[model samples]
Target chain A: MTDISAQDFHDALVAHKLIIPVGVPGAFGRGPVFEDVLRRFGDLVTEAAKNDTAEHMLFPPVIARRVFEKSDYLESFPQLAGTIFSFMGNDTQHREMMNCVHEGKPWGQYQQMTDVVLAPAACYPIYPQLTGTLPENGRLVDVQNWVFRHEPSPEPTRMQSFRIREMVRAGRPEQVADWRDMWLERGLSLLRRLGLPAEPETASDPFFGRGGRMLAANQRMQKLKFEVLVPVLSTAKQTAVCSFNYHQDHFGLLFDIKTADGQVAHTACLGFGLERVTMALFRHHGYVPAEWPAEVRKVLWP
Target chain B: MTDISAQDFHDALVAHKLIIPVGVPGAFGRGPVFEDVLRRFGDLVTEAAKNDTAEHMLFPPVIARRVFEKSDYLESFPQLAGTIFSFMGNDTQHREMMNCVHEGKPWGQYQQMTDVVLAPAACYPIYPQLTGTLPENGRLVDVQNWVFRHEPSPEPTRMQSFRIREMVRAGRPEQVADWRDMWLERGLSLLRRLGLPAEPETASDPFFGRGGRMLAANQRMQKLKFEVLVPVLSTAKQTAVCSFNYHQDHFGLLFDIKTADGQVAHTACLGFGLERVTMALFRHHGYVPAEWPAEVRKVLWP
Candidate 1:
């Protein structure tokens, strides 16, 4: 269990000048130290995944609304999705929107949906692009992109917008599963090498409502989602710093992805919540990077 | 004017396998080559700004709604802004929302405004942070973050969400203006060194409506905004790959940022649209980095 409270962590971040709050509760502008640590951490992650032979890719934060609609995100996690709204009104309607904004009324009513939506996950855009038959051995991709979720809290770890470094694989069932398992071990070892006490446990997404509870239970029962946990805020309530998920042909069917043998492809991904990992580092180690354990410093800075 | 039509660029992007459109018209998933080039470009920008002594920073794409409201974005460029909307309804409202989504009706009505909004520019979050008093010399910050704009277009250069690499300075009026001018020259030279035919000219933001026209004219009349143009899609029209702006205390007044002399600090910034620059490189050179001019390759790849 970590001895740090949420307030303590927040104060340390502010005092060390690592983060600047933009008067928004969960949003922040990170300082040089924070960016330095994040870049080094990303480099380490890249170093670890070099053997995976993953194709590196980059993506914008927003996705096409049509592609998003096809992802079934609206059905699974409507509560946490952020849809981009724009005012498409004519001059008169624009006047109404302006009036509402000036008068502090419900101005959102005048806004209409646009073609783009904020991406819920970094890998969402990747799967759609792989909608055809793969090579004989299938494919692996490494992506680092910003992701959005609507959870606004003062915990510092749960940011409204964050980056996720993900390795997504699509191949035969055995191949995909093996890759996921291999990364799980590799990920745990990497964090342990950094002196972070991490443990892998079965987990589930924050699914919506009553039906979602059953979906969550089924997901956990199948052990399809596993998260590497670290005690950031509390010992009993650990934060998930990394997650490994096996979609098991769900995406293959949606995107029509298939192996060379014409069988539906199996997909899995390992995601590291960059902000949470950084916060966990600050929580266990000192807020100042220089004060961290010598071994950890050597692993990261060296 | 370059003879490349929008379709020609799109076809070339696909032919070179640099980008994959994910069944969406404008949104794309970049490949390894694109990522490599973008990373190298970012490093070059960092190298160019080494003398500025700017503190590098990172920010989340979503910002506090209050901060965004205070920026007067709704009053100036509401057409290009995107507000994050999430489902905040009760279970009853959730059911209705589900019904609307299932029935193919507009269901955005169920979302309530969170404390956050999508950031329109990389520099918007920096001003509110420097709200108090600056040191004697004021401050300089380097920011590279993904920004969102609501423009939906078939033109490949205009992405809905893209990355912007920016250097922001806050100080006395003369100091800020000088920095902007110096950077304008520096930016043009850097692009020219890369074998890009670049030119700097007075520019203006795409302000909205009748009143916005005057605001834009006034901004241009004051010689406040300048952009480096390169012929990416068309030599006839060209594209603004980089921009330099002197805010002349506009942000200082809004954020209450003051200099050591007890006067409002003047602000300036130089912004390079990462995707635009990369696209410009591909356009001026060849689509393949290996086939690019040796001098350009050495500058970018070295």
Candidate 2:
């Protein structure tokens, strides 16, 4: 990719058959091509979901708070969690609650149980369902959902909320590893096909703040996490377009995802960020989406 | 689509290729196909963006509260707004703010001016940008972003927040209408190819309560609201997978989206729900993702 001014880059986008938004509220906001791309891929993905032996299930964005509690996510990563809830008292009661604070009294018991929470990760729903399954072997699930986290960075690198596409497997360690590796290869190739060069690097969920530094160091040391990198605005750092993760037995044990033979399964997961891929394409293919390479267009138009 | 018992449905999912959680949190949680579908669509979207004639740009999720004030979103839909703010104060003061009780003396100022709120719609950003330049013709913008609302329905019908792939046109009414019609056709074919049956129905956005009832009524009366529907549990009332919207300069005039001739431009948009399409696929195929059709497989694999 060559250095291009905002105007030059934008004009290129228009020429390439891309649709760009004039502006949005944030740096990570979306554009017209975004939907076009989603539906484009949706065609292929829906096919993948229907071909297999697994059932195709659609889940909601808000999961039961207790499910997250069981997964130890709260204990493992507190700061990153974007807890969602709303006040429920009627107007008069709500006014009374407000008045108590106005009078300088310690009003306790105002807040009640939290029934729903914004999902922190894309694969949260799969864990709970895996608990009561029979397959001693690994299985796959088809899902699409929004995810949330408290990211306060100007770098679109960490949007407060983002969409995550995940492929999760729970089975023997070797099977899980193989599944992750295969998807990783496909993911990288997809990026390459899109005309963007990407590299795989270590990645980690770094437990959480203050103490999370240790988890970060551990991930760097083990080189277990890998991400497909994409650079933004000529920055040396690359944003992660795809992630391959080996969660080991942490989730399997917690969710009791035992093998078909009754042994605890090892779990691994792979994730792709659709928008980030679009962003990388913008950077790699100049700005014009229409004039993209023939190979990229073939699959797109096909 | 026949009504399958919950257990039988789950078994079908397992047989079909769904990798379920031993115990899932909610009905609409995510899995492997989620990310896969997103990435696939993402590539095509970028292809479209590059080909579009307009320049592309990113936006922030946080909209200036004032923008909403000017747009009348807050007054019209207070229930849907998600305020973006922070508890601004020193550690001691922050602690006090946390302790703020209904009956207690109110703590120090907690709400500071953040100049932002969660973006309700993507077009609001375009209005402000167009104020400075009245492009004579061909004023168009394409954006995809995370949008928020307060619907509490579970699974395919509702989500607290989700991805919105939008193309907003700010030009002459004829031009905007032309763009909308083009997208409407393109979008329908895209969904059809995915094997998810969808129809283009005239549509309208529900403004709100009693007063907005008229808008809803108008939409139904004119068949302005078009939905692509399908059966998930059983083939009955189908879910609206996508919608075509014609704002008729309501927003253009409010935002002063003027053409070079110094006239309020006609504006329109087409929106896509990535998850809904995925859901439609799941319901159409079965819970197990592995059983998808060969045609669907060709799209993803090729």
Candidate 3:
């Protein structure tokens, strides 16, 4: 395990036919075995969270352009956002595009922005829906959707398009904090139960620029973010498989979400990187599910 | 039901809170009840198809740009393809984009095309994977993924981005034809079992321009495509809930897929529009699932 690098793990996964490479760096297809394990893990997560009466919603991978603008996501992480573009043109423009294709020139210039942007996170759209006052206790939502980022690397864990299963809570500050902490413990235990050496550590979003560095430091100092780490690619530098974040009132203020008491709602979310967790299972418990520990098998297959 | 139009149905869905309007036509979020019904319906589909022994594969919504180029999709349906664009620029270009954003100008100019395109169908990527010789019985794959088309309309069923569950088969001509006919019947039966008055009719892809019209007419004349139609928005004009297509060496020739006996293979696919079927259920049955017919409930929830 100590000798395994990210490249080695990626190659092994490809060789074993678990992942079908699409010739892109971080974008690939999951084979039957990989999809089976991922589906089971997702179901296991749903079972674990069934106790909480959270409203489940499903959104497509794209969000409205106006929502993306209001989220101020580009200002914080401009490099990572993916904006959708389509060829909204007439026949003449179409012919020009085809000519560009024939001539081997850049035809993307003819494409224009659509009304949507690839969603950066599963929980971003939920805030817009939370406008106005919430209930006294809070509002909780369960979201599982595809998210997009522009970062493309050879590491299989860092996929450009991936799925995130998230639980978002918006309400009073104390309630949000308690929920975040509770989920932090629950997420760690859930992963550990699956036989991964999972641990919680302070984390920060990869904010951009000089000011972003200061913000990252402040976030870390305030213990605003925690990630459950597992040695999927390398034991020396574990990958973050689960993230719990407390965004005090960043989203609440932006979306005008208020608590029943009329104060700005505090928000927190716990997200599980579905692919990373599945990869971690393959790494720790062997590629074959039948060879995995019986306890893990029961926990997943049950 | 006779007087209900597409807009009326959309308004009803939004009013019932089953669908969350995202300020964009043909794009919306599914609320809890809607999601619950959709999940159950997806499970029912999987259960019905389990006996086929098809290999299941999951791909992201976007596919490699090269694959899109090789598929000749743009030639026939250039207007309906979504080309993903990203801001792969430096600090200076980023500043320019922010300036455009602040000034309310078109900032999409700063974006560049990535190495991928939004997939137009669930089976497009599967063709590329079946490049070489197949087994004696050919190969069958089950794919369920998000697909994108650039058609924007007020009709909720005409979503720009939607999910499609497809079973793709590639082999000799007779084998392909038999599989297509088999699935066409299965699709009709499954929809009928759900208590929908479903029927199969000849169909054709919406090819572009005059040449495309000829291609479409020829397709219908050759009996290459059929659709399972149900009255969703209008009783007069039914909607296509499922599609069955037979590609006689179209994809096989492009991908060089050969049979085990050293001849070119043929391909066919049967696709179910998951969202459309769920919407049809809501349209046919009462908006409330509990009040729906018990037989329908038994089929879905079982």
Better of 1 and 2 by TM-score: 1
Tens digits of per-residue lDDT for model 3 on A1-302? 66487788898899878998887777799998998888898998888888889988888888888888877687778878888887777777878887887677888878888888888999988888889999988899999999988888989999988999998999999999988888888888889999999999999999876678988999999999999999987888899999998999999999999999999999999899999999999999887888899999999887
What lDDT score is found at residue A218 in candidate 2? Answer: 84
Backbone collision tally, model 2: 128
Per-candidate TM-score against the hidden true structure: 0.97, 0.61, 0.97
From the highest TM-score down, the ranking of the candidates is 3, 1, 2
Better of 2 and 3 by DockQ: 3
Error of 2 at A11 (Å): 11
- Which residue pairs clash in candidate 1? A1-A235, B1-B236, B2-B235
Docking class of 1: medium
For model 3, residues B1-302, the per-residue Cα lDDT tens digits are 66487788998998888888887776689888887887788888788888988988889988888888777788779878888888777777878888888777889878889987788899988998999999999999998999988887899999988899988999999999988888888888889999999999999999875578898999999999999999998878999999999989999899999999999999999999989999999999978999989999998876
Off by more than 4 A, model 1: none
Candidate 2 docking DockQ: 0.15
lDDT of 3 at A32: 86
Index of the highest-DockQ prediction: 1
Residue-by-residue lDDT tens digits, candidate 2, B123-238: 56656655534576656666655565655542433555556666677778788777777777777777677676676555556564556678678867865556655555455555
lDDT of 3: 0.88
Give the whole-model CA lDDT for all candidates, comma-separated.
0.85, 0.59, 0.88
